[model samples]
Target chain A: MNTQVLSGKPLAALIQQRAQDEARVLENSGRHPVLAVVVATDDESTLWYVRSIERAAERLGIGCRIVDLGSEATEQVLASVLRDLSAEPSVNGIILQTPLPVGVKADSLVGLIAPEKDIDGANPLSLGRLAVGQHAFAPATAQAVVELLDHFDVPVAGRNVTVVGRSAVVGKPLALLLLERDATVTICHSKSGPLERHTQPADVVVVAAGRTGLLKGSHLSPETVVVDVGTNVLPDGSLVGDVDEASVTGVAAGLTPVPGGVGSVTTALLLLHTVEAARQQEPAQLAAAASAARI
Target chain B: MNTQVLSGKPLAALIQQRAQDEARVLENSGRHPVLAVVVATDDESTLWYVRSIERAAERLGIGCRIVDLGSEATEQVLASVLRDLSAEPSVNGIILQTPLPVGVKADSLVGLIAPEKDIDGANPLSLGRLAVGQHAFAPATAQAVVELLDHFDVPVAGRNVTVVGRSAVVGKPLALLLLERDATVTICHSKSGPLERHTQPADVVVVAAGRTGLLKGSHLSPETVVVDVGTNVLPDGSLVGDVDEASVTGVAAGLTPVPGGVGSVTTALLLLHTVEAARQQEPAQLAAAASAARI
Candidate 1:
């Protein structure tokens, strides 16, 4: 079977357009959507990701504030910043960029991000709300996988989806999202013995384990649609995903590329979430924005 | 295959003993562990369940407070009561019983329960904390499933576990608990067409769908161990589980009995949680209680 490449560029562009259009309506109603990206580390790759988000926010007509606290930042400092950002009426969304300095735990600080402004769904409250089928923002990366699958017209309801990994950010949340969509989801991790035992039987396989080339052709059936959520930076500075592209290409019916797959769509979704947060935070502005859209 | 009955009586007895011993120590320190059960409905079955809990608490030497708000209780009144209970220093654990009054959503009221006293884990914050592997109480029914399995020496890590339900109270939280134990867990619901498709491949199957005879012998392999979490009341006023015990008995390797299985363990776990909550809430009293235990 010839495998089809599920590129995320088209989906990203479509989402970016939606966000841009919504931002214009909000701006016309005198409400500007602002996203706060809190960075506590000077990691090169992390900085690059943050810059990309800023550029995307600018293009979408959303305000972007980069709060860069140096590597010597303490947990108390991070907590205070998050609390202040959460309370800031001007800030519509907040994203605490990963790769925190030593001794600073992200989990402890994320709870301070109010669920309303938690665009990336970093807050534990957001996750719990998501689990119980309540209104809450799901993590953008995890939502990206679902959005990408929907864009390509892949069915999820009652379909067997095996999410390989159990991280709170991706695997666990992704599973909950899939479950919400009525898809039978199985979560496999490091201790799951052989990957093929879970992957081969799945209608769709989502690899978010962060291990480069962790899944190969032998681990899937020909009918499998694979979504590669892994973005591993190699020694040569090139990026790859958990699924081995070379071997998985012809063996799987569909495969999402590492760079062009879940990553591109994730950034776009973040902007969409920001505009959504802005609209939700200001009910009067949201009404005006809706009227403006109807026009 | 000759099936072995996994009775919860033994585990419940053991846990009750532990709670009793802990309660005795706390009492000696002049601290009494108290559990407040807030009931909004006058449902007969719910009242019966509450009375059973009261009886169990009495046996364990834990104080039980039943706050009956009647069936006409409004959301505001319920919320106010929950908030007051959350603030009460005497109340170590809070349980808001189900079948809440008409027009009263439990989700909205549960959030008012402080996480420190949310022993039943009804609050979304508690559920979120559990998902992220933070310190929080899981719903006793969900936790009982794990404890019962452990008491019977069922190996969960690296095993295939098919949970037949998607409820917040049982299936969802239980899945998280099982995932934390490194089990490759699949959650199946009504949308999942055939029960056998998901349950047959599993080493262990947990049925919590609240449907009588939802899982039959045909849904399992000869080697499968089943945990029935259902407690459905029949028209004859007799209670049965999701599993068809008569049909599943001779086919499965092991099965948890309906009345004697997960249900029994659940009430016992709640008492244990109340005592544990009391110990955590009073630090100085906890230290003294610990010393008393040493004696």
Candidate 2:
């Protein structure tokens, strides 16, 4: 059986080009799209993700501001910094990074970020809006899976899809998004009875449970489209996805690799969301300026 | 094979009595809980629902004000009326009835209602909050299914539950609520392949597809707990649920009746939410008043 690899680099480059074009338009209109990423950790993987976002921002001609609060950053200080950025008119997008200081809850802190500037969807409110099918920014990883499928021309409508996660960030919102596209969705988590029972019958399977190699080829159909959203770091400092690639290499019709697939697309989508946020804020900014001038 | 009816009337009465107790406590504290319902059409079913809410409010000692915009109300007029009711300080709860006039959309207008008074979860924002596990009033009908299950001590955590329907008000929100209770949920809609394929494997099945008798006895596992949220009227001027009562009577272990099941529980939940909304609002009102007096 021959299998096709769904690489995300080409799609990410295509999206980055579009975002660059939109960023130029906004810049020419005197509205510079800026993304402020707040990192309160010293974790290597977290830093790597932050740097990737910076690189993607440069490609899109968007301004990237990385605020490193170090490992000792208190929740109070982080909240204040986020609130200040949210009120800053120049900051079009705000992202609160992971590996936050111990005892600091991410959602409660990120919820303080202005929704209009929340490009990464770290805020729970953004997830809620996505669930309700309202206009809100979706988490980059979840959106990446959908974008990858759409770019590959995979049929999602009326298909039985199993999403292996129940996270607020990925599994839950991704299920809602898939359901919006008319896909019959089943969400399975650790508590789910048998992963094989859900995955074997699904036409498409999306694994984002963060467990390394949790899904095996035996859990899939012969030609199922598998999109792995996991980025588990191995002990040898290598990255792996939730699906066992060796077992599923020939089993899946199309599969996304851990490093070159979802990761690349996620960074690109974040910049794209930044440009989109700028576009949404433009009209409101103009209206406010006009009102001020009149006053 | 003996079927037992999951009657919602007793549960509804019990909830109403609790709401009555809470309402009296608020009244004695010099704060009256008032629910303002906006009706934009003269549809028989819509009016019947409004009248039921009014009657329930009276029983609970809660004030009910129905704002009827009649049949010819435009979208602008309806929006204005709803906005007015939403801003009224005396009104503690706000609900907009369905079967709205032509060219008027329910969600866009109802979204203007303050989330504090959004008793029925008409707004997308309220639905979003519910999705995020935040404190927000959920749509009464969706909440009733869970309430019914909890009242009956039906186990949901780690159970395989199939939910039929995907309507924003019922199926979508109900699935989220059930998921919150740790139920591994499968959401099936019109696009889903077959009803039996999903229903046959579920430990619990919730049917809210609005089609009468959509779920059959053959679809059961003999002891599956069924919560039917459909309220379809029959030719004989009687109401029937989505489940065919006769077909499932001797097959299923537990089931809920049509008129006396989810409907009664829904009305009672609405009042319960109204009282909860009043409790949430009173603290803010008092704090604001105290600050003003101090100033």
On DockQ, the leading prediction is 1
A60-132, model 1: which lDDT tens digit per residue? 9999999999888999999989877876677889999989999789988999998888999889999999988
Score each candidate by Cα lDDT. Answer: 0.92, 0.87
Q: How accurate is chain B of model 2, given as a TM-score from 0 to 1?
A: 0.95
TM-score for every candidate vs. truth?
0.96, 0.92
Q: So what's the TM-score on candidate 1?
A: 0.96
C-alpha positional error of residue B71 in candidate 2 after TM-score superposition, expressed in Å: 3.0
DockQ in order: 0.72, 0.58
lDDT (tens digit, per residue) of candidate 2 on B164-252: 99888898888888888888888989988778888988889999999988999998887888999998889888888899888988987
Candidate 1, backbone clash total = 0
Off by over 4 Å in 1: A283-295, B283-295
> Per-residue lDDT tens digits of candidate 1, residues B1-295?
8999999999999999999999999999889999999998888999999999999999889999999999999999998898777766778899999898877899888998889889989899889899999999999999999999999999999999999999999999999999999999999999988989999989999999999999999989887999999999999999899999988999888999988999999999999999999988876653543454354
